[model samples]
Target: MEQANIQMTEPGVSRADLAKLLAQALGNEKASDVVQKAASKLGIRRDPLDKGQALSVLEQIAQTPGLVGITARFAKSRLHLR
Candidate 1:
């Protein structure tokens, strides 16, 4: 089986940064809804997502198939992992 190239974001990533990246990747109007749904689905609490939770949301979107996933991967890449 071919392993997928999953890129991980750095720890301590701020919520604002993640939200900005998602907005850039998807769109300004849709980012909030998407994050809300993703967090709910992932069982993550709302209001100020911690580093791990934010990363999880990013990874979830990244794994989604189609433009959403592709764009998320691109956005995820912009984050500093090291």
Candidate 2:
């Protein structure tokens, strides 16, 4: 991805919470899947995203249909760390 070096602030939401929010937003059991896909797309072969990777993943997610506003709200707010 061209935006590989994105920088990110650690959010206040934990993995579970983030998944919960994403599940709610997407209305399915695919929040974690989304994260994984983004991570894979970014070529991240590890658990617990580094700050930049997290932002990059979120940025990718934001581009999905119906997710811009939801992701904006999440990105705008502090997410809890797991």
Best of the candidates, TM-score: 1
Q: Give me the displacement of residue 58 in model 1, in angstroms.
A: 0.6
Candidate 2 pairs with clashing backbones: 11-79, 12-78, 12-79, 12-80, 13-79, 13-80, 14-80
CA lDDT scores, all candidates in order: 0.71, 0.60
Predict model 1's lDDT versus the native.
0.71
Which pairs clash in the backbone of model 1?
none
In order of appearance, the predictions have TM-scores of: 0.66, 0.56
Q: After superposition, how far is residue 69 of candidate 1 from its true place, in Å?
A: 0.6
Off by over 4 Å in 2: 1-18, 80-82
Q: Report the C-alpha lDDT of model 2 over 16-61, residue by residue, as the tens digit.
A: 4445556765644678777667667878775565555566667676
